[model samples]
Target chain A: MSETKVFGMTPTWRRDVHTHYCPGCTHGVAHRLVCEAIDELGIRDEAIGIAPVGCAVLIHQYMDLDFIEAAHGRAPAVAYGIKAVRPDKIVFTYQGDGDLASIGMGEIVHAVNRAWPLTVVFINNAIYGMTGGQMAPTTLLGQKATTCLSGRTAEANGYPVRMCELLATLEGPAYIERVALSKPQHILKAKAAIKKAFENQVNNKGFSFIEVLSTCPTNWGLRPVEACQWLEENMIPYYPLGVFKDFE
Target chain B: MAKGRVEVREEFCKSCGLCVAACPKKVLRISDSINPRGYRPAEQFQDGCIACGICARTCPDVVLTVYRIDE
Candidate 1:
């Protein structure tokens, strides 16, 4: 019998430690993509990840790399400071909708406008998973969240923010793409987008942003499988999925 | 013939069943038993896996690894 090699195990950049994210949460998928990018780019030592104050706050536990914890909505600013001093290093931020589109809006906008050589992994699960499924700035209209008990209404909660479109408007960003984790096909595209974001930083490109539409099953009151379907049927239409901007 | 096998990191799997739904060969299933995390992990119930890797890609936890061996 001949031995066949089919697949490789986890990426070296990912730690062997167990993750604390709930079952079916896409945060783990996003984390794995980032680690795969780092390993593929041969930047494991030069990569510095800035963790946000959301569900991914404990990202340092899963990724074996240099990571810094930033206060709520301050990851972009913190990443900017790190990249400014160590221009040779690959710096990136993992932020959620609440942390990025809400209080950190100004910081992200200014940083992207400044064209810093850094990457941003934006996880837009619509609702804030860490804070008990509260409505976030990216929550779709008519979506149900703890803060919006009766589903989000345009008249009441205003419209959900389209971050990729918003950032693409600025002249500083070199790349911007939005991908989803609802299915295998979508996941492959998501990995490509994430890899490109990291590659942009490696090439000294300025302000690469990859927004990932993820699932939060526990808070959505749906089974893990149902949440993926919900994200496809409801969230994808509102957020859409594509590259908003790519200078390369 | 070359056969594909899957190794589930039992301790890390949350047993959300996404992989079970994703396997094209239908070789995986959620185990009746629970892991240390108190979640049921997906187990390989058959030996016809093609190592398509769809399951690993679809797994949110990155707990499953697929390998091919000749028999």
Candidate 2:
């Protein structure tokens, strides 16, 4: 027989369909990673995904697993309720920068503080890609967005929030890390982290947060190629790479 | 062995002019004409690029890449 193939053509956790996200958007990569994790964990039959508002609100549409649409910034809380009642079910949330870092910050912090047994997939693209390229909490300084056409300014807008690094400081998150879907190596690493996060939940470890430094070319008024570069040069420096905290 | 070369899917290019600014090697140039999408997408790159993957790394669209030169 031929050598064992590491990657499969289509993940069992996905519906073998496409999403409405713009071309080259990292939402697809993030969705693929979640589908991969669900497939790897063999939880496809008993998995539930909470999708928040933003570009990926329709994430449930593409995923094959049981899905529910949560109010903006309320996914974590909703995931918590579902996980608490159906402790046997594997629960996760898919949220974007605006949903998590902005209006949903309180819910996210509270959930993590409670050490909820759920996995969180946070996609941060710097700008609000869905709402027509507005500035977001993760938007880099001097980055030109629709709201901040002249670029983000410290004096005016303040600096972007480093989500993973800051969350790692909290004593609740069992596993906290930031990964990118920009390339093969990074995607491999991200896949591993995503799997680990799900494993942590399955084993009842605690709060697991994986912030993906994703890209949004259409909103950024850039080609998919250039947006990835901007994320590396500008976003990575502020966010950095590696696991901030792991209690395993 | 040399590293791989860079690949750019110019069709998805919105051409906000970031790649032209990000490429330190000056490998990427902008085209005067617009793409079918109606955006001023990026122009073609000539040889002599180091294939550092910086352009690909910095791009948010996941469209550009630096291929292995030896391959």
Candidate 3:
């Protein structure tokens, strides 16, 4: 039964662009949440996105808003500049774990410390999806990656970096939340968190950071379903989902 | 009475089966047929659809759109 009234379609802010993300990759889900938040806020015309150097490096192709490509892990710093000049516009950065939690760590820390008015969507997929499944800073202890073929050990590889927990300790950010895309219920929570992060910027609040625990089926070397199940069973326990901090 | 139905844009579907797993009403299934892109697209059973849009929301590829008819 084909119906006529459209209850839901892809968000308009998302260009009619086919994503290159591997099947079952949650990056597309994250992309939809960002686009949906922009559409709901009616900020499509005024919204600007900072694309990072990761699996979502080609984010500009999927999102229809004005975008500037940032170097590896420097999206927050780039967004800082954009927000300072175009204070009237909505600015956001979309970054992946490899780019955000590793090389861009200092930049993100500084931006949050300064309380820049911008939205940051951090995708924490545990492994570096773009660079052929390399271990990322957010990779859980004992998680296997190309670099850590025998599983990450605390003795040699150090510990997984919990970005939300680290940033919430700072006094600058007004909102900080971590959500996941492993299930339908989790997806709804993620959307709400994403929207709140965007709303913080709209309300002239300080930095709003939403760290999304996403899945990397290709990198994780698992079927799409298995990847999501693995995320629920493994990732959620370490990176618990919740609002780390919210001033408002 | 069915409240809503899903339209699968076959060309874009990666056949990840997330929608099938997500449908609370259990109305979706991966078709035996494969798309030109070499992936199986989800097909709706059209029987118990409440049009909750959960399947569409859960879709990573934006391959499915939920449409509801006026009662």
Judging by lDDT against the true structure, name the best candidate: 3
Off by over 4 Å in 1: A2-5, A13-15
Each candidate's lDDT (Cα)? 0.88, 0.78, 0.89
Candidate 1 C-alpha error for residue A240, in Å: 1.2
Residues A193-237 of candidate 2: C-alpha lDDT, one tens digit per residue: 999999998898998999998888788777766777777887888
TM-score of each: 0.97, 0.77, 0.96
lDDT-better candidate, 1 vs 3: 3
Cα lDDT of model 1 by residue, A1-248, tens digit: 65554655556535468888888898888888898888988999899999999999999888888999999999989998898799999999999998999989999999889997889999999988998999998888888899999999999999999999999999999999999999989999999999999998898877899999999999898988899999999989888899898885
lDDT of 3 by residue, A49-68 (tens): 99999999999988778999
Docking class of 1: medium
TM-score of chain B of each: 0.91, 0.75, 0.91
Interface RMSD of each: 1.8, 8.6, 2.7
